[model samples]
Target: MAKKVIPLTNTQVKQAKAQDKEYILSDGDGLQLKIKTTGSKTWVFKYSKPFTKKRSNIGFGVYPEVSLAQAREKRKNARELLAQDIDPKTYKDEQQLKQQEIHSNTLQVVAENWFSIKQSSISPNYAKDIWRSMELHIFPSLGKYPVASLTAPVVIAVLKKVAKEGNLETVRRLAQRLNEVMTFAVNTGLIHANSLSGIRAAFEKPAVKHMATIKPEELPELMQTLNASNLQIVTRALIEWQLHTMTRSNESAKAEWSEIDLDKKLWIIPAERMKMKREHVIPLTKQMISILSVLSSFKRPYCPYLFPSNRDPKKHINTETVNKVLRRIGYHNRLVAHGFRALASTTLNEQEFNPDVIEAALAHVDKNTVRKAYNRAEYLKHRTELMTWWSEHIEECAKGSLSVTASVVNAKFG
Candidate 1:
């Protein structure tokens, strides 16, 4: 037969006094009040743990601090847990540990973790910009908050404020970067889902603006200005190399001699140096080879780069070197170093060259993963012919002649 329990009253609990030794007074079920010799009273709940059938006692706090009614409520809730075969003490401990984890893993902490992994796959400059954006826009406001507590509304409000300031572009980047961090959190098990995925829709998209560049017909005049300009030999060579190869500013600036294969007439940029994180092969043309030859004359013997920095022989020239040179030569706002790629793309497409080959030469990867894999080496042959034609066309544009012999083109543009 089950033993019957008589619940205690408020008056009896209030008037109860501690004896010489500690003793307990039962309320009902698993609830009891233990009064110590020091007059301290604590509410204890005794129960047989589920599965193990082992007896355990858990405290609901002290007497006046946890009033009889409050203790009774806790007892009721605990009984429900026990009825479902969940040990109340283990449940409480697990909940406490989760709360501690939430408090410890702040957004900034997790972002730092995600960035450490992300930086290896991107350029150093880009990595700096990402961290700087977070520091300026995000970390100041919400960095200290736990990632788990980062609800969509709270994050959207932050982005909306940035949007209202006419920094729509910044807001766009912030949204993208924040989404990455949140998605990283999800993947790392710090959070369950990325609730902030839709935050980008809360702001207006920035207007598309192509890089500024002169018309293809103006290449001769620009080349004339470049030739007349009193620029350093290495800087001019850097600009010409980038222009001829149709490579990005940083990619050209950071070029290493080892990446060039003179025998095969190929410059193979490793996956790490490329923007899309894929290896790019540029068919070195006659003009590109000439630029390399010019750079080779003054190249430091110990330097691995074709265009080493003037101030630091160990490092390559600044990525902005060509842009500054362009501005100095009166092409400010008229042309940028990046404008070289656009100029090349426009000229090739206009010349009726294969668009896919041109895109491949430009190092633009196909969006389709499977097709991209198949096409990586597919366009090399077509690209070789296309590069030769483009180099010849550039020679014609420079010489202002209809036909250019190999020797004459090499002598003039090379």
Candidate 2:
């Protein structure tokens, strides 16, 4: 015989009072309103596990917050799950876990985690630049979105917006960084896969704009202008040192006396200070030594840098120091400090120096990894000869006798 069941009415539920002991009021179909001795009422659903046939109770919520009608509806939903062989409690638990994951695995959260791991492998200044770029470009738009929810199209659209502002290079860099962050997210199990992998293909590739520089024939004129300018002594020496060594502006500016080995006749820049993250050994020429001697006379006791900032002796000169000097000396838009590398490359290539040795001297990363390893080991002697020749060429230009280097290069290569 089937037991008859009566459903709870709103009036009865509202008026029900808690006794000395806790008791329950049936709402039919496994729904019950339980009243505790403390007067707190709650809704509960009693059901049997689909596989084990074990009875279990799931809390719908506290009563008044969940009325009789709502409790009945929850019971009806649970019954449907039982019909489909799904446990209502397991389903609820899975949904709660998914919600927790969504709240915790946001794009910004995952990206920050990834950056923390990435910071150890790169220079502090470079790491700051990367984080600042993300703050400016990425975090504003999609930071709150869960990494699992991010799609390639969504990220590509954001990049395309950056591209529209004529910052194609910024867009390109942002794409690479964003991809790295997303890959980190995948590696850390935040997302199933890297959905943002193809986002870079959405934007136009940035144009390659070489640094502005002067032609080889104009070297003598530039040297003449540099010498005639009433520039500060230290600044002039810094420029000459950078040109002679063919090092980047910051690398030259940040040079320490300890890095210069008089016996070895080499300026050994540590890996941390180099652009390629490898130690660079520049063979010091007699002209390079002469410039160092001038700097030695001007060196402040408190400053470790060859080109200390005028405002702060503890820090090296700003990277823009050479550019500003060039602009002030009437070379605006035509030359920059970094342009010195291009100048050296052009002159050396024209003189028929081996391209591999020239690239090695410039400390450029070779595209062929195997060849790069071989060249680094094999090209030091050749690099020294080439750098010595370049310094002599710079000296001839400074003397306003550019043709002297031509005869030397011809005799050497011949």
Candidate 3:
């Protein structure tokens, strides 16, 4: 009941031994104020709430920091709060929780906010890819760890886990990218550290395992087999399109009929879908036009897709369909769908075309300034010529000509 109020005058407080000068003040019925050696006093409320039923001591404030009159007022307030069935100790803990929440909503939270804000600026495909890597790999591991707590060892652990898989190259690349994300967070003053730079040198890298492309001479037979295979019509058309237009698999896999202008004899790959992040226009050869012509015999129009699936007929060709077919035809490990472009590049170079012209045909940037300055034609003429020769070459292999094999082309390119 705390009815006793022991107050010490300044002289008595000074006279008492340092250890003996404890002054206790009783605030009404339930609150007690205790004065310490340094002349500071605080209000303590001793009580028990529900559940555990253990006694709790809550400090209101220091003496003078909470003056006598203020202390009495607080005691009355505390008693009123207690009467209302609220535990003062629990109420104070709830307040501390709120204050902690406010501080936590700072730079680290702001970094995530910025990432979301900048997401729309990038292509949706890239955004999804990056977000996936962050969510699956980065966030699960460190999302709740404060950005300030981020360090080299922590970041290295995330990458080493990926490196343990056979994809050493991708692990290396993602490690570099993650560091960039962390550096970006730091530039915003969220992490105050660029952990990427510190850990970049520490990650052990594996030697590159280059996948060999089909020899050029060998490509003619391969192409002939692909063209004649009883594969799905969409699959056949896509293969012919790759050979004729020399476009990437993903670019052609997601091709919309609208991206192709039969009358204009062109295929315009949007910047978002292109790995180089630039609009690429491919000059369609007569062979390519024929392939598209066969594909358009389906139900979908110029709006949805040129190569919509047969089963659903509402969706574009699954990106993996080409690789799946390659495996089906026994080129699983030796030749991939992407190998078609590499084979075409080598063949085109062997056919005595200019290097820049061939690169332009592949929609690659020319390194020479002089060549690039006036090289806007994008090899439409040469690409057309190359496609005609390429199609005929594939036909020669279908006829089983001994002179045309992948081995011969391999020697030429090699």
Best of the candidates, TM-score: 1
RMSD to the true structure for each prediction, in A, is 3.6, 6.2, 11.8
The C-alpha stretches of model 1 lying farther than 4 A from their native spots are: 1-4, 15-19, 366-378, 400-414
Runs with alpha carbons beyond 4 Å of true place in candidate 2: 1-44, 48-54, 60-91, 366-378, 400-414
Count: clashes, candidate 3? 8
lDDT by residue (tens digit), candidate 3, 159-226: 77876776666666666666656667767655556655766576567786655468986765676666
The residue pairs in collision within model 1 are none
The residue-by-residue lDDT of candidate 1 on 185-265, one tens digit each, is: 999898999989998887778987789898999988887787667776688778778888899998999999999999999
Considering summed lDDT, which 10 consecutive residues are worst modelled in model 2?
401-410
TM-score of 1: 0.89
Q: Count the backbone clashes (under 3 Å) in each candidate.
A: 0, 0, 8
Task: State the displacement of the C-alpha of residue 61, model 1, in Å, after optimal TM-score superposition.
Answer: 1.5
Per-residue lDDT of 5-71 in model 2, one digit per residue for the tens? 7888899889889899999998878888899998899999999999899999999999789877788
